[model samples]
Target chain A: MKLSIKTIIPIIVILTACTDDIINNDASPSNIFRSFWEIMDERYVFFEEKGVNWDSIYFDYQPVFDTVRSNSAMIKAFDSILSHINDKHLSIVSNDGHYAGMFLNDTLHYSISFGKVYSTYDFSNLQTYSHLHLAQLPEGISYIRILPGLKKINVNDLNIRQYDYSNGLIIDLRDCTGGYMSGYNFCSIFLQDERVVFYKQTKAGKGHNDFSGLIPLKIKGENIIKKETPLIVLINRNTYSMGNGIASILKENTNAFLIGETTGGGGGSVMSVLLPAGWSLTFTQSKHYNLARKLIENGINPDIENIPLIDFWKEEHLDTGKDPQIEIAISILQTTK
Target chain B: MKITLFLILIYLGGSTLLVAQEEETKSRGTLHNFRFGIGPIAYKNYYSIPNGLAGGSMSFTYQMEKEHKTKKRDFLLRANFDYSYLENSKVLTTSEPLFRRFKIRLGPGLLWPLNLKNNQLHLQAGGNISFYGEYIYPTESGGKHIYHPIPYGNWSINCNALIVARYQAGRITIEESLKVAIFTAGFFPEFQYTPTSIDNSYYWDFLKINTISTIPNYRMIENKIAIYFPLANNQTAISWRISYNHYNFENSQKYIEHNLGVGIRF
Candidate 1:
């Protein structure tokens, strides 16, 4: 009935020991690698589409991970294994900085510089708003350049009514890396009727092929721009993800003509998971497809493939005459009139 | 020097008066105490964060005790609410996220005296039906703008067993209490297939994915030790408490917390 400090200390120690079985805190390289592999196997949605043999990946990388003694070595080993799947959305970020699966080294070859486009053209009423750059090109053409992300914007404040697009409108989406799917809002501005732009499916279970039913991505008809107006979308290999997606939607649903090289494909929605080693891994968790049920992960082809000859990186090459994509769009609009 | 002497005299007189008042009210029928505490807390919730989070916790507790003729037949009721703001231990950058936790508990029990030797040492066994709910979520927007932050939470009704011991040495009382959840019925979320978002029926989805858990999958333990020192007024006491809690569910999610706080009981 009497309890002493000695009795209490021992009882506390015993109870603490009993609770130790609850969590596993193993931080060994092999355990971390297994955890990483298991998470990818369960959550990653592109395994079958990318033709990734996940089991083979584990078989090849497990031994290397087991022998790695340092964090840097483990990261390097992860980078080597992850490179097999060429998904730019997939990346590993640790204290050492971010390591991406794929880098767009040839972006300059396919895209024109936004700075050059801004400076070269005698654009009137130039205004850089949130997520949008508005300017007036010659012959009553409206030039609207979309920025990276599709953060919510006040459509009314955009003063879009002030622009006269009787000749045409150009939606420049070059080098628009990616952002939220809310970019659909920008696409809806020119839509004449409600249209299904794409279909998307997210993971439903742990299995690689487990996915929810395809949900149609739809944009409502705002008809801010007249349906009769000629719309031209400029894109290049540097336009990716939502940028590429918006281009495809506008090209397929609207009377718009896409003029540029093929878009950089990144159709998946990405999600991140924190690993036990203090590193975070981001990968695609959803798949996107065009209205025809064809996968859009490989990039969308333009209606008229026009690659500019001018070196976009050079300030001296910033000339409207040298930008064949823009020149062709202007000529087409002139002929239509 | 004269003013200092006068102050010392007044302090001694007040202490004598407080002691006299304490003796007069030695046998009271019912007692009520309110305690508010704030202290550092070390926390980890494996469901949301992999590493430990360091933060501060604030708690408010109200207790009512009904005294009886026999020491064994004492009735007690307690209710507590606690809030904690815990951040990742890593140096926070713009990308790093912060998390917060909320908890509330209510319990009613009877204490039975195990030993009443010398009236200075008291040991008691207590049993309570306790209801507890805890929720943890990110305080900031998550890593990238694309991903939605998922929150982890659980609620449980438990049969709690407590062993409480108190020793009085002069003007200080030292108390140690160990509480263990002997039986628990817990509700926890199943493994999520996708992150929750506004576009989906996330609330309904969460309801459909909930699972009931029992002792085999849920376990909880808490131990607290406190030292109380009576103030000059004798009606109020200041105490310092240190508590440790461990909760595990489904063998996959674990939460641990350590708290050190100072409070006033009146």
Candidate 2:
């Protein structure tokens, strides 16, 4: 049978309209989440290691899910929450993770490459180091410069991997937006106390946990080198989420002196959902804490506030080869300790 | 409300078109035909007596067209029925009466068609005569009641002169026309006396009720002036006819009602 011209045209028009609707309809989560959940449940290698109850996990989380209202907010929430996990190997991979710094974006990726370290007063010479930069100033103070969350560099790896620390150490967190909270994993190299390592802030309030035995780094296969080296940590406004979190951990338990700008205020552990529409959303799962639930959302402030070194970099056109705030720690070690 | 009734008329007309087509082949050359239709209907009347008044009627449409030998001109005879009622309630507190009335019309006209690509232009002009068929009135006295009906005929007349232009686009053709009808004289004794009472002064109020003698023995004439636009094609088309009908009673009272109808061409 043959169709008339009039019938054919209307049929074509109706089909085109239906196709338009199909393309525009957003994919709902119900379709994508089930398969993803099934795959992870059956095949994830770390399913047993992480001690995660995959089935109960979905059921418990499903009822409390809220739709992400905006994209930017989702990214921010994702970055903050992922940073709180404190495991160097685990971190959210996204384009926004580059907030740590332009140089960090280049160097800090999933894999770690060990290289020579150097430091300079001028940031314009940062590329000169080509690897991590370690600066020794006028005093017995040492500065270790690098952005966090850009690498899978665990503290155990660092402790085992040879590095000399003869003077008071200055850890720079300026412009360090944040990454995994595992900075405390290497604390044993300088801190010996097992009292308070960090604070985990949940809805119920603050809970203190000791990382003293968490990352056990064994040196020479015999003794635990618990170096009580006096530490001075430097932070700036960009010392966000996990950066502030680690700083809070160090401040309460160790001899670390916090200096320079106040840390970025970002509390809560983030929960993320990969939407069926190929979009992702991240939200705060729980609150944050400092000392006994002191200041949940408010960030960690420094012992002394110093002018942001970026201001001087802007004024003098001298891009410090490393975080100048960390240079401040090296300078403080020369004068005070 | 008038438009609603007109839609029902068209719906019934649609079914009639299908039924009528079965009996008659598409008429060729010159043709004249009449269409009769009716449907189940119920509505509240607005007369001063029986408030809920419900009734139905058979509508008639007649169209006659003849092609001229020399020119593409055609003479057409058309007729339509405009039936309605205004019913009121039994004597509750207001000692007013209630009644219902129906109107009908017939028109004859000529048309000139100009051929065009994808459409046709038609210029048509026509005139018509219209009147009521019956009037029913009910009276009440505190505890007593009475009912009555009066046969009314050929009460109003109107001469409609319309110049319409029509265009056919595929299955749809649209026509717009201007019409002006002048009221002639009534058909009964109503063409004589003039009453000044408020109730009788308003021709519409009296036309709405039913009374034997009180049904004024006067001429009820109407003049309609309007612009009508109808879009239609071979199978189906929607016609929107908007017109103003003015009533002139011998009682020296004048009233006007607006009319609109959506019709389908067979």
Candidate 3:
């Protein structure tokens, strides 16, 4: 049959369109996996430091992926590849932008009441600490209340730079929803050694920016600091992110006691991305590791487990009693040689 | 004139009754007899970036059983839409390159089944019309930041035909659909078909690296068959499909998306 231009072009178009369709489909395992890896490898800010080889990993996994006859199998294979990185943060976010097992938290309220507060030694009535409150127990344990920001106390300004670690220190990390890792520098004065407190894991190429290993406690000029002092850290549900990181560090490195509720489970090395969609995706690129190699995704369970002091004393209604949890730590410290 | 009038009256009367019979017969069949579906939507683009982007969409459908003469054949229709986009950074932000299409779309086709009840087997074929739309190019330093309307200059349309088969039991149904389109014909002859709009104007640009390159051809191509499942009960129905989409331009493939939402049937 002599094909007319109308029939010929459309016939050719049909065949050509079929070929093009085959070329651009996105559900193939190789393409799906490669696209995922490509986005992470190209966009993750710390690809190199996290030790990922995007291309080789994709190549190695592609055949295995192609062999998978089912989507369940494909997902299992993908997960296996992800787990190999040992990162909690590296994960496949659903197209809708929510991670599995993550929930938004906006609970826990703390009040600030204090006996005294100051910033400098010249001590002009000590400008009351904003965003931070101070509380002192009759038993000599002092409480510094802070939110997400760093609550720094220069060791020299503790008034006890002149005195030694005689009395136990109670750092109230309760109500702290988390802030910068720099907060650890100010909080580490009570630690004795540079110890691995946590490890962060990430897929080598997919945007896993991990803290690598435990944040050790190393004071300037001094090899050993607060070696004999018994430290007690307080936490509650409000503690999150780096707040949990701090608690984990202290738990692994010092003789500190943790009091209050388990922390929010926000453990993961984050790779922050400014997507073309305008919002940011702070993806979990790595899993968190304690010095013991134990992953700490669920926030740390406290050592003493006390409710907030105000609630604990709700029945007594007394303004001047010892915080029972802090009292317990002091009791334990008083007996320490 | 009297004879002509009589014939016209007879023809009009016959057609009116035929249409009425078709409607009456169609209403007799149960609405949720057999479920059918198509692959999800797909999009690929690159008029502004280095390697372009690509993805896909999927859906499911259900047809009523034969209730009257109109529903006797168990005929039902299926639909699909797919596309790809590609961009090159080598082209300067300002000077108009040999060509640029901010975004392009190539699908939204239909399918019909010959039989939907006997062992859930059927012979099927349908057609689709694919068209392209415009996209805005991003600005650059020392380059003019402006918006120019091409008014379908880069826009073109292609036609498609597909073969499909399906199986259904109770509330569960599985289906596969294969398609061929004229737009696919004009692409790479060996692997893809090129559309008329793409003919001669852009080809082999990806093979050569220049100060500017055409968007990758892979984004405009379709690479895999798709599976569709339409789930239904009393109050709500949904179609879920999954397919592989690819872009040789970016050397990437993605099992991106395939899902649909449908209202409940009585």
Candidate 4:
């Protein structure tokens, strides 16, 4: 049979070039193990800094996974291995609706109340928006309480410009769960000129600790808070991820004094992968550091650690009078005003 | 040096074969092959979209091939278009007919035949301007999607290369379709889409909040084994095909689909 030119040319090209690695769609235990091991092996960027000998991890866990039969068991097994590395961004959620999100949050907990603090501040005028609470407290002071899991709260809508005349601004991030670091750079406005708030080093090459040149992260925008307003940022143990990113920026650039407990450090972003066993797992691939280039996985600290002892307050049978942290913030603002 | 000599020998051998095939090349005629077919598609996802069996799936394809006799070898021009849809079921989508994906590919290819015994082994490789869109249908559970009528779409170029081993013994016709690089970039947007958050009221409103990374980055492998049943005319025949589609996207998307479809080829 005479062959056509269309058939002959493509055949030679394909035959000349050898194809590598066929797509693996198998959902068996072996395939699942291989996918997990290989994906982490190739993509996990913090292997060196994390100090986990991944090769040994694979060798030790590879055999163990062969014995595991169920998705839940495999998820737990993978979690056990990943737990060796300390990264808040790492998480795993099984297809059966089992989430490993809470497992990775480091053992640090804190709670605060906007209602309690509001009564303590005794603001003359107060306003509430979607995710914002603003108070025009007496003595030329503007107190803004921002809560966690914030949605698209526009800074322009915040009427932050109105506070240009105010003597001080309080950005309360207490008890807030972290979110994306995209919106509301109201604190950056206080910084007059360009300022390097942090430094970012990404894994550019394959080797352990093979990082890119330390790139300075400037307070991203212009002086949004044009006035050099004496700002007080309230933070506690729960301030996390994007909140931490914001707190780090404010600490480095603004005159804002962070008064509360330390933050929950989740500096890196979350990246996820799916296993052949119909399970999804997430882990942090990059490492983020403060402008000082210090690993921020360890949360940022407050300028003045006036964290009120909850136990002391409980023993005294007092609500607001014994809360040292709130009193300290009010005293400082009062003096500044 | 040895490899260079080996390549030289191949060149000389090809030259001799061309000289010997001058008469046969002159005798070959212009050939045309055309095919139109339709089948069903199944949808599944564990990444951006909810995963489960779809309500229904439909697929259609039309291809035209031309072989113009040339001096060096036979030159070929091929163009084909494929469209497929996988309807959303309530279990995965929350809303009845939650969403559906429509993909269309239009491409022209160059075919290379590489056998002397009936020359049954053929390979075709070419690029296609691909258009893929997943439209979210409105159902209860709130505000309409931000992308309203425009299905979240990613238009990109794709390279498709396939091997066809056609064996015709008297009346029996067999073909094995080994296709590599069959447009695996569906889940990946052509550009970086600003990440959004997910809320209950407006579900697929790409303009808002996001709790997870639903963007799919795919690596796929496709294989089909088809047999054609001959009719009275030799050119027209009915084909029974069983194809396997392996979809691997990021870590959240992995599913294998075994498809069975019947169509006529001319």
- Candidate number with greatest TM-score: 1
Task: Report lDDT per candidate.
Answer: 0.66, 0.40, 0.42, 0.51
Which should have the higher TM-score, number 1 or number 3? Answer: 1
Least accurate stretch of 10 residues (summed lDDT) in model 3 chain B? B189-198
Q: Could you tell me the TM-score of chain B in model 3?
A: 0.36
> Alpha-carbon error at A239 in model 3, in Å?
1.7
What's chain A's TM-score in each predicted model? Answer: 0.87, 0.53, 0.53, 0.79
Question: Candidate 2 lDDT, tens digit per residue, B1-266?
Answer: 45445543543443233223212112225655444444322322111111122233344555555667576566666666654432223223333332234555565666665443321334455544333333322323211222112222334444445565443333333444554554444433232111111011235534443222212223222221122223453233343233222222321221222233333443
Candidate 3 lDDT over residue span B80-139, tens digit each: 333322222222232332122233443444454475445433445666665533332222
State, as a TM-score between 0 and 1, how close model 2 is to the true structure: 0.33
Residue A196 of model 1 has an lDDT of 74
Q: Give the Å shift of residue A45 in candidate 4.
A: 3.2
lDDT of 1 at B22: 20
Judge candidate 4 at residue B208 and give its lDDT.
31
**Preferred candidate (lDDT higher): 2 or 3:** 3
Per-residue lDDT of model 3, residues A1-337, tens digit only: 1122234335323433443343233445566566556556544433453466767777789898677765456656756666544333344432223332122313334432323122211112222353454444334444555556553444444443432345666666765765544455544565545444455544432223423344222333222335666677877776776677778877877777898789765565343322221111234444566777766666889987767555644433234543455445556656763
Ranking by lDDT: 1, 4, 3, 2
Model 1: DockQ against the native? 0.12
- Between candidates 1 and 3, the lDDT winner: 1
* Candidate that would win on lDDT: 1
Ranking by DockQ: 1, 4, 3, 2
Q: Quality of candidate 2's docking, in CAPRI categories?
A: incorrect
What CA RMSD would you report for each candidate?
A: 8.2, 34.1, 22.3, 12.1
DockQ for all candidate structures vs. native: 0.12, 0.00, 0.01, 0.05
Interface Cα RMSD in Å, per prediction? 8.0, 38.9, 19.6, 11.9
